[model samples]
Target: MTHTIRNLSTLVELRSNEVEKLQSEVAAKESLRERHQKTLDKLTHLYESSGASGRLPMALALNCGDYKQGVMAMAAHQKVNLSMHEADMAVSQRALTAAYVKREVLGQVLEKHQHAAVTAQRSQERKQHDELATQLWYRGHK
Candidate 1:
């Protein structure tokens, strides 16, 4: 019985550790998600303000004033688009990482639970075996 109790305690400890690890992973992922979202927003805003479209009145005015200025604006817009694409890729990567972490944590917890169940079953079987042996021994003495 004492051994069984010890085994139960160990199982509880493992469960606690798993929970803590999962919580930490969740927090890290959430932080990464927020940072990625902020980066994406900044890139989108930059792209919008670059005036890539020739139809924009401001771009047309710049084209009238200086062909060089219109070209620069277009170049800036292209740079902004590239930045947006990079940010999008980063967001996708971060999201996938978070998902993988979540799955891994879940798997670990499940494994621990399975182990605990097996231990408990073994402990019960041992107790029953011991009880049966004692009963048989007492009957034989009588």
Candidate 2:
């Protein structure tokens, strides 16, 4: 029985480690996604603030238009990349949640096994104590 408890504890520890690893992976993914979003925001801001004003000389306005077009294309690409990153992050999050649940279940099982082992030990001790008390009473009476 004690050996069984030991095996259970080992399993619980393994599950805990798995959960921690998955949590770190999810956090890393989340951080990457946030950075991509910031990049996209900056690109959009740049596209809007490009120097395409009516007061610009004709040649300069033409150059600004070309720059705007390039920025727009880059922004589109960035958005697609951001979408892919978000999808990956979502998958990682799901895996992390599942790991957390499995770890908790294992922990609960270990707790139950330990409690049963302790209870059994105390029961055995109580029986031995009761027998000793009865033997002393009988000896004294005789």
Top lDDT prediction, candidate number? 2
Assess every candidate by TM-score. 0.45, 0.92
- The segments of candidate 2 whose C-alpha lies over 4 angstroms from its true place after superposition are 51-55
Give me the runs in candidate 1 sitting further than 4 Å from their true place. Answer: 1-79
lDDT of 1 at 33: 56
TM match of model 2 to true structure: 0.92
Clashing pairs in 1: none
List per-prediction Cα lDDT, in the order shown: 0.65, 0.90
Best by TM-score: 2
Instruction: State the local distance difference test value for candidate 1.
Output: 0.65
Kindly list the per-residue Cα lDDT of model 1 for residues 1-142, writing each as its tens digit: 4565466557556656655665676567657656655655665565556654456698686654465455446656666655675676567566656655655665566567668878989999999999999999999999
- Model 2: lDDT of residue 91: 88
Question: What is the C-alpha local distance difference test score of candidate 2?
Answer: 0.90
Give the per-residue lDDT digits (tens) of candidate 2, residues 1-142.
8998899899889988998999888888888888999999999999998865567898888888888989999999999999999888888888888888988998898899899999999999999999999999999999
Every candidate's CA RMSD: 8.1, 1.5
